[model samples]
Target: VNTHGNTDFRNLFSQLIQKPEEDLELDRAALYLAGEEYPEVDVLSHLAQLDAFAAQVSQRVTHETAPANLARAIADYLFGELGFDGNSGRYYSPENSFLNRVLETRTGIPITLSLLFLEVARRLGVRCSGVGLPGHFIVGLDDTGEYLDPFNAGAPLSMEDCRALVDRMSAGSLEWTDQFLEPYTKRDILFRILNNLKAVYMQGREYTKAVGVIQRMSIISPGLPSLYQEQAWCHAEQQEFRLAIGTLEAYLQEAGTPDDSKEVKDQIKGLWSTLSRLN
Candidate 1:
C-alpha cells in the first residue's frame, strides 16, 4: 500500500468538511480522504464515473416512473450488469474503505458499496440515505422507505430481515431496534468510514496512518475526549511518549472530571516515567 504523506490532501479534506453538512459532497470528500493513502487519486474522474453510471440508469427509467422500478433499474445496472459487489474475503483491507479504489476494483465492504449505491442513487434523482446497522451498512430509499443491501448485490431488505441481520452480525449480543435503520447524515457516513480506516490501521499497528485517521475523525467531530485518548494511544504505540503525554494532558484539560479521568491521569504518569527513563 502506498501511504504517501501529503499535507495538501489533508488540508483539502479539512476544507471539504468546512462546508455545511447538507452541502458537503460525500464522494469528493471520500476521494480526498483516500488521497491520504493514495495521493494520486483523481476526484473528478471518479465523480464522472458516477455520473456515467447514473446516465446509464436514467436511460432505463423516467422521472415519473415508480420508485420501486427505478430502484430495480439501479440495482440491475450497478450490481447485475456492472458486477459491483462486497469484498467479503478481505473485508478489513483499507482499500475497501477508499471510494477511488472501490470504483476501480468494483468490490468493497458494506459502507463503500453502500456509498457508491447512495451516490449513484442521488445522481439519478433518488433520495437515498445510509442505514447504519450495528455491524453492517446498507442504503435506504428515502422516497419509498425501502432498504437495499448494497453489499449483497443490492438486495431489497424487509424490516424483519434487518432485525435478523443485526442479530446475526452481532451474534445476538445487540438488541434489535428501529433506530438502527435511521438514515445517517453525510457527516455521519464520513466519520464512520474514517473510523473503519482507523480500526484497520490500529489493528495492523500502522500507528502513523492510525494517527492521521484519528486526527481527521477529531476534525469531523471535534472535542471528543475518546478521539484524544485514541490519538494518545497511537502515539504511545509508536514510542513517542512525550507526544502521547501531551495528548493525554490536552484530553484532561478538555474533559475534566469524567469517569475515566483517574485512569487517564495514571496513564499520563506512566508515560512520563517511561520518558524520564529514556531521557
Candidate 2:
C-alpha cells in the first residue's frame, strides 16, 4: 500500500483496539452512522459490510458440514479465496450505485450487507466489529487482536484512508478526530438508517415523510435537538403553526446557542405570532 493507504490502516487498527468488548451490538453503529447521538449504545463501529457478509454465511450454512466448519470456511473464503488486490480499486455492483441501491431497496441493501458480514464473522469466531465512520459504513475485525478493515474487499487500510474518508464527507468545517473511529452497537445502526432516510426525504422535497422519519428518530435518539427542529420545520411548511412553535421551543432549549440560533429563534417567534393570529 502507498503512504495514504498505510495511514488509513493504522487509524482503523487504533479504533478497533480502543473499543470495549461489550458494545458489539450492531444497532449502535447504525444510529451513529445516521448522524444521531444515542448515548445508550456507546460503541462506534460501522455496519457497511453486512449485506455481503450475510450472503456468504447463508450460502455456507446451506452447504457446509457444520457451523464450526462453516466458520473456518468463511475465514478461508475471505482471506484465501478472495485475496486482496490493491489494483482492484473499489467495487460497486454494476446494477446499483450506493445511493441508488439503498434508495431503491429501502430496507435491505445497506443494512443487509452489514448484517451479513457480522453473521459470518460471528460464525467464524472472529473478533470482528463494525465501524460506522462518517459518510461511509465499514467493518473491522481482530487479526492478532488488532482491528482490520474488511470492507476494502478484505484488504488492509492505513489511518490515512480513514482520515481521508472523514475529510471527504464532512461539511469542510468539522475536523476529523480519532474519537470518530470507535466501535458502536446495533441500536445505533437503526438510528443511522432512519437518519439516512430523513436526508433522502429532505433532499427529494418530501418534507412530510422527512418529518415522520425524524419523529421515529426522536424515539431512537430522544435527546437530539436537531430532530425536533426538523420536525418543527415540517410542521411550519404544513401550516401547523402551533405544533411548529412547540417543536422549535423544545429545540432551542436543548441546542443552545449556535451561529444559526438567532435565525431559528426568530423563526420560532414568527411562528408563535402566526399561531396567535390563528387562535
Candidate 3:
C-alpha cells in the first residue's frame, strides 16, 4: 500500500519512545495517538479542555477530604452531570477510540473512558491508577483500593463487581485473580489503547491505519515481538511485499524457538517467492 506520510505522528512517537518508561505520560501520549486519527485536532486545545473540567471538579471537592469521598464527588460530576457513559451498542466503533470524539459524544468503551477518568483524577490531586482488569479497564485510587468502572457511569466497583465483570467477559468460564487489581504502568496503558485502536481498524479491514497503530505500538514498547508480526501481516494484506518481508524478518529475530517461529519462517519463505514472481 502507498504509505501515508504522517510527520506529526512520527514526531510524537519519537518524543514519547525516548522517555524513561516509568515517566512516560499515559494521558498526553494517548491524546497524541487519538490525534493521529484526527489530523486537524488541536491536541493542546483538548488538554486545555481537560484542565478546565478538572478545575470545575476541583471546586465541588472542597469539603470532601477523604479519598473515597473525593472520588465519589468526581464521579458524580463526570458521569452524572456531564452525561459520560459507556457505548454498549457499538463496542468496537473507531469513534470510541478517539478522545476528541469521546469528548463530543460523551460515550466510549472501557479503556478510553478509563483514560479520561485517570487524567481528570491526576489533575485534581486525586491518587488513581489505570486497571487493565482483563477485558475491561477500570480505575482505582491509591489509598482506598476502591475501583470505579468508568464505562458504567463511573459506578463504584467492589471485588464482587469486578468478579462479575470478569465472568461476563470470559463467558462465566474464568474467575478473578489478584492480577485483576494490579495497576497498569503508563507504558502498559498506552500500548493497550493503541492495541484497541488497531483491533478496530483490522476488524474494518483498514490495514493502513492498523499498520500505523502497530508502528506506534512498536516504538512505544520495542520488546513486544507480537507487534512486529502484526505489522508484517498488515503490510502483507496491503501488498507492500518488501516492507512485509522486512517486518517479518524483524519478528523472527525476537521469536527464538517458540512454536510460532516455524510458522513465521514459512510465511517469510512464501513472501520471498511472491517477491521473486513480482520481479
Answer with 1 or 2, whichever has the higher TM-score: 1
TM-score for all models, in order of appearance: 0.95, 0.54, 0.91
Q: Give the least accurate 10-residue stretch of model 3, judged by summed lDDT.
A: 1-10
Model 2 lDDT tens row, 1-279:
111112332343334334654644443333332232212322233233444544665676565355444444554565456542222232322211122232233223333344445555764455555667787665555443233344344434456777776777685655988767676565565566666666766776777656756765665566576777788877787787877887777777766775577888898889878878888
TM-score of 3: 0.91
Using lDDT as the measure, which candidate wins? 1
lDDT of 3 at 273: 98
- Candidate 3 per-residue lDDT over residues 1-279, each given as its tens digit: 233337686677569867886567766687677767787877788889889889888888675478788888788988999999999998889898878888889999998898898888888888998898878999988889789999998888988888888999989887668887888887888788888988989989999889888887777777477887888888888888889988877777766666678888898899999989989
- lDDT accuracy of residue 267 in candidate 1: 94
**Clash pairs detected, candidate 1:** none
Winner by lDDT between candidate 2 and candidate 1: 1
Which of the predicted structures, 2 or 3, would earn the higher lDDT when compared with the native?
A: 3
RMSD of each: 2.5, 12.8, 2.3
Ranking by TM-score: 1, 3, 2
Cα lDDT for residue 80, candidate 3: 94
Which candidate has the top score in TM-score?
Answer: 1
